[model samples]
Target: MYQVYYTRDKAGRITQKLETIEGITHSIDYSYDLAGRLIEVKQDGTVTETYQYDANGNRLNNAQYSKCTTK
Candidate 1:
C-alpha cells in the first residue's frame, strides 16, 4: 500500500508530493506553466517520467512504468 500527501501553491498549483509505504519514502515534484498546464513530473530523485498534452487539454503522451515480481 502507498499513501500520498499533496502540497499546493497559493495559485492552487500542485508543487510537491510525498509518498510513503512500508517504511520507504518517495517524493515527487511538479511544475506547471502559467496556463496551469502540467509540463513535468519527477519522482524518487529522478526525472523518470514526463507528460505532454495537446491544445485541447488531451493527453498526447505519458512515460512511466511499473512491474511486480515474486520469488
Candidate 2:
C-alpha cells in the first residue's frame, strides 16, 4: 500500500496532499477565497486549475491550464 498525507488550514480545509509510492512522491495543493470557497488548484507547485464564483456562492466557471498560467 502507498502512503498519503494531508495538510489543512485553520478552518479544516485541505490545503495540500502528498502521496508516495515506490520512492516517488506527488503533491497537490488547494487555495481558498476568503469565504472558504475553492479558488485554485496546483500540482507540483504549479497552478493547474482555477475556479470562479459569483456573489451567490455558485460556481461561475472552471478552467484548466497547460503549464503554469495566472489569471
Candidate 3:
C-alpha cells in the first residue's frame, strides 16, 4: 500500500506531495499557470509527466505510462 501527504496553498491549490511507506519517502511537485491550470507533475526528483488542457478545462493530452513486474 502507498500513502501520500499533500500540501496546498492558501487558495487550496495542491502545490506538493509526499509519499511514504516502510521508511522510504518520495516527493512530487506541481506547477500551475497564471490561470491555475496544472502544467506539470514531477516525482521523485524527476519530471515524470506533463499535462495540457483546452480552454474549457478539458484534458487535451497527458503523458503517462505503466509497467508491471513479477516476482
Best by lDDT: 2
For model 1, which pairs clash?
A: none
Off by over 4 Å in 3: 1-3, 65-71
- Which segments of candidate 2 are over 4 A away from where they belong? 67-71
In order of appearance, the predictions have TM-scores of 0.65, 0.86, 0.73
Write candidate 1's Cα lDDT for 24-58 as tens digits.
88889998876787777877766756778887887
lDDT of each: 0.80, 0.94, 0.82
All-Cα superposition RMSD per candidate = 3.8, 4.6, 3.5
Count of clashing pairs, candidate 2: 0
Model 2 misses residue 35 by how many Å?
Answer: 0.1
Between prediction 1 and prediction 3, the one with superior lDDT is 3
TM-score of 3: 0.73
Comparing candidate 1 with candidate 2, which one achieves the higher TM-score? Answer: 2
Residue-level lDDT tens digits of model 3 in 1-56: 67889999877999899998887898989988777888888877677778888988
Please give the range of 10 consecutive residues that has the lowest summed lDDT in model 1. 60-69
lDDT for each residue of candidate 2 in 1-71, tens digit (9 for 90 to 100):
59999999999999999989887898999999999999999988889999999989999999998984499
Q: Considering TM-score, where higher is better, how would the candidates rank from best to worst?
A: 2, 3, 1
